[model samples]
Target: MASGLFTFRGKSSARADIMLGLGVAAALILAWEAVARAGFIQPQFLPAPSRVLGALWSMTTTQGLLWHAFVSTMRVWVAFLLAAAMAIPIGIMMSSYRVVGASLEPTIDFIRYLPVPALIPLSIIWFGVGEETKIFLLWLGTFFQLVLLVADDMRRVPHEYVEIAFTLGAKPRQVLTDVALRAMGPTLVDNLRITLGWCWTYLVLAEIVAADSGLGFVIWSARRYVKTPEVMAGVVVIGLIGLVTDQLLRAWHRRMFKYL
Candidate 1:
């Protein structure tokens, strides 16, 4: 059963899916370039893909945009790690104990509904306009939702597994660490991947407050001068980073949980 979860027999179909996705992406870019060149869309508003690529090259070569992208990536990693470290343990406790779950779930759900953008002013006041503010905002954006996701995953662990552990004379701690966490590890990683994507979504918001560097700052700076191509370039960089990281996480998941 475990092997079945990871080992698909349809290798050809998987390859076809990849090909289809690439074909669609290429078609869209070609269409976009054609529309821009035909003057249907003004370059100021929506630059051609080639123009955007040129802008990206100029930024990387002359404006140190690569450094800015690196800084943004680092900030995302720091925030994601911090949130995961706290959420994973708390989520486990919430799932294991009725009292804990009941006491915290309502509060977590309430906080999750509070928009991260609405807290921007307060975060600045509390942490100042520095890396702390950005990191805090990113954490705030993902932590509450992730805690709930982790808890839900934990609750889905099979009761039969736990019963078998108990029948084998396993202690509570053993059952939790040796059995439950082991079983839930794959799902937890999957949840982390989802939450990491959310972290990327919040990256621009995090860096926009007082940031002088990063892709968000680049976009804002371009906006001031109406450098639409540069702005698009920055956005494209962010999207590419998110896509690459998401794919890496998926690969890691497949590698680690071959039985999933």
Candidate 2:
């Protein structure tokens, strides 16, 4: 019987993991509802999940929540793509060439440490109080981090891959394109996923300083009126957005690198 039991291996289902995750989420929601309904916390301050959902629905129906969400999403993608465009190439160069790395690493590392939010005043002055300024702020928050991450990813490419390329008489540019980039594709996808999260985290900071519209603006406006439910609703929306995008990126990563 013990021998039979040892041979009774079974495949695990991802659905089981999904169900467990949902179960945990439901339990947390129930716990929160209980706390709110039991008077354990002030409703005005904490706001029940139901109240926050109602506020979210109200915003959706009357206050253009969907539009604000779309605008914020667009801003995030725009800044992320722009940062990726510049960072990927520079990062590749830094990894592939000693001279380029030496010339840029110190400055990039130094500037990266100087808090991005602190540059709000300089960004406002340089880009003006427009969409440009907001985008610049978002870009500033994400770009340097991405550059360093991408450079590190590139550096992680196996030395043997470069040696093999050289054995085949491959040029430097060809080695970069065919070897380094290709080998680092999975890591690059992962780094971008993480950096995208960083971009979302900075969204409120980027949008709050400027004019109106977006999730951040909604939260900021609600804060002035002491609308706890609305503030919670806005926070919930941002969390949901980030969660959805993170999942989508992970799915893409799995599809693209199924072997891994």
Candidate 3:
């Protein structure tokens, strides 16, 4: 059992992994609770997990926490989906043709390296202090990175696969669609999963300037009032949502590519 738990680069039961992860999390939470109770830190600075939980309940019951969370989730999904839709095709084109890659890769690299927060003023100016501005910020954060990942994934497809398809009398389009795309499907899905997480990371930045209803707004509002527990609760909700989303994507990936 110890060997099973401690193996290096070896497969273990999923149940064991889940249990171990939960155990570590529980230990950390208990330690935090102890520290808070012992007055090692002021509650206002670092509230006990129990207090945070209470705050979460209160917010949910009276402060529209669930509505804010739902709004944030919707914004994230919409932006991420739009980014994926545009990036995947552009990436495929860039990888399949030298001209496309040469023309676009440099521009994408230049823009992606620019600090996203720095563009917030421009985003608001262009789209106004509305939903469009928020979505654009979220989309901008995800698209550039995802496009590069998609192009790399396409490039990493084995050359021999494309060659084999060509030798079998396949046309250029068929080779690209049937061989390259299929070969890179798993990596593309994985990249999409990673970039979706990035969209969530930008949520607070997206909503910071002009947002009335979002987890970001809730957290920012709480900070102004020094409502530490409420702020922590909002952050914890985002973390939980991201974790569940990542796990769901992993499960879908495994199921979709069982042979992998």
lDDT, candidate 1, 15-112, per-residue tens: 56687789999999999999999997778998999999999999999999999999999989999999999999999999999999999998999999
TM-scores of all models? 0.93, 0.93, 0.97
* Tens digits of per-residue lDDT for model 3, 1-260: 64666667777787888888999999999999999999978899999999999999999999999999999999999999999999999999999999999999889999999888999999988999899998999989999999999999999999999999999999999998899988999999999998998898898878767899899999999999999999999999999999999999999999999998
Residue 64, candidate 3: C-alpha displacement in angstroms: 1.3
lDDT against the true structure, per candidate, is 0.91, 0.90, 0.93
* Model 3 poorest 10 in a row by lDDT: 1-10
Clashing pairs in 2: none
- Over 4 Å off in model 2, which ranges? 1-12
Q: Candidate 2, overall lDDT?
A: 0.90
Clashing pairs for predicted structure model 1, backbone only: none
* Candidate 2 weakest ten by summed lDDT: 1-10
lDDT of 3 at 248: 98
Descending-lDDT candidate ranking:
3, 1, 2
lDDT of 3 at 125: 89
